[model samples]
Each structure stands twice: as C-alpha cells, then as structure tokens.
Target: MHGPDVSWYLALSGLMFTIGAIGVLVRRSPLIILLSVEIMLNGANLALIAFARHFGHADGQVFAIAVMAVAASEVVVGLGLIVAMGRRNIELDVDKLRTLRG
Candidate 1:
C-alpha cells in the first residue's frame, strides 16, 4: 500500500471535515454532533501529521499530538455532559436538551 502524501492526506482530511460538518448540520442529537466534531478534529490531525512527515518537521507532529490530547479531553467532557443530560430523559434531540441548558 502506498503511504499517503501531503496532497492525498489533505484531500482525505478535507473530505472527513465535510462529512463531519454535514453530520453536525443534519443530526438533531447532541451525541452525534459531538462525534461529528471529533471527526473534524481527527481530519485536521491527519493533515498535520501528513505535512509533518512530508516536510521532515517535528512541529506538525507535535501539534497533531496536542490536538489529539484536546480531542480526548473534549470527548470525556462532552460524554460526561451527555450522560448527565441523558439521566433526565430518553430523548436525544438537541432541541429537547436545549431546555436543560443554562
């Protein structure tokens, strides 16, 4: 299998972002929206790693790692909120959950 070059990785990353964007736009559930946002972050990380490898620079890889840490933290916090919100009801509709928001 061919290793992904910068352009190919960038294209794939852009596609991932687009898919995530659509998911966020079309889904009415908070969990799905959060997952979609994660997809976007992963795409950006992929692009950063790709460019880092291509340029022989450590910065992009370092940034990618940082982004990953952020994404993980986001997932933890978002899921925690989701669980707290879920305890209130079975419905996952974003609109219904808005009432719980301050």
Candidate 2:
C-alpha cells in the first residue's frame, strides 16, 4: 500500500503554517495566539518529518522531537503568563498588553 506523496504533505504543512500565521496576526486573544503558535510549530514539524521520510534520514525526526520539546515549554510559559494576567484581572487582549508591568 502506498501513502500520499511528499508533495502532498508539504502542501498540507504550508497550508497549516499559513493559517497559523494569519491567526497569530489577526487574533487579539492571548489564548488564540498561543493556539496559533502551536499550529505553526506543528506545521513545521510536519514538514520536517515529511522531508526526513523522503530522504530516509533520522535527523529530521530528531529535530522534530526537539521542536516538540520547545513547543511544550512555550505553551507552559505562555499559559502561565495568561493565568497570571487573569489572576490580576487584566484584559486578555494582546494589543492592550503593550507593557507587562505588574
């Protein structure tokens, strides 16, 4: 059985990245921005895995794992900030958060 080609995977990855970029640029909520950043990371991971598969190399997979780790850390920190903002009764709008002074 044959699966979809590398081009298809690349196309999907590009589409996901584009959507994520648009969301990050247009969305005002911190939660939405975080989600969009996650989407972008996933999209890059997809491309890395696809290329790794195409080249029959383990490097891409290794990089994907590293990327996942970074993404997890980013989510942790971002969510922590959001929670702190919430605790302080601050608005969740990114545009209004020009200064994160406590």
RMSD of each: 2.6, 2.4
Which candidate tops lDDT?
Answer: 2
Q: What is the per-residue lDDT of model 1 for residues 1-102, given as tens digits with 9 covering 90 to 100?
A: 267557988999999999999999999888899999999998899889888888888899899889989999999998998898789766877866555583
What is the C-alpha local distance difference test score of each model? 0.88, 0.96
**lDDT score for candidate 1 against the true structure:** 0.88
C-alpha RMSD (angstroms) for model 2:
2.4
Question: Which candidate has the top score in TM-score?
Answer: 2
Instruction: Score every model by TM-score.
Output: 0.85, 0.93
lDDT of 2 by residue, 1-102 (tens): 179989999999999999999999999999999999999999999999999999999899999999999999999999999999999999999889766662
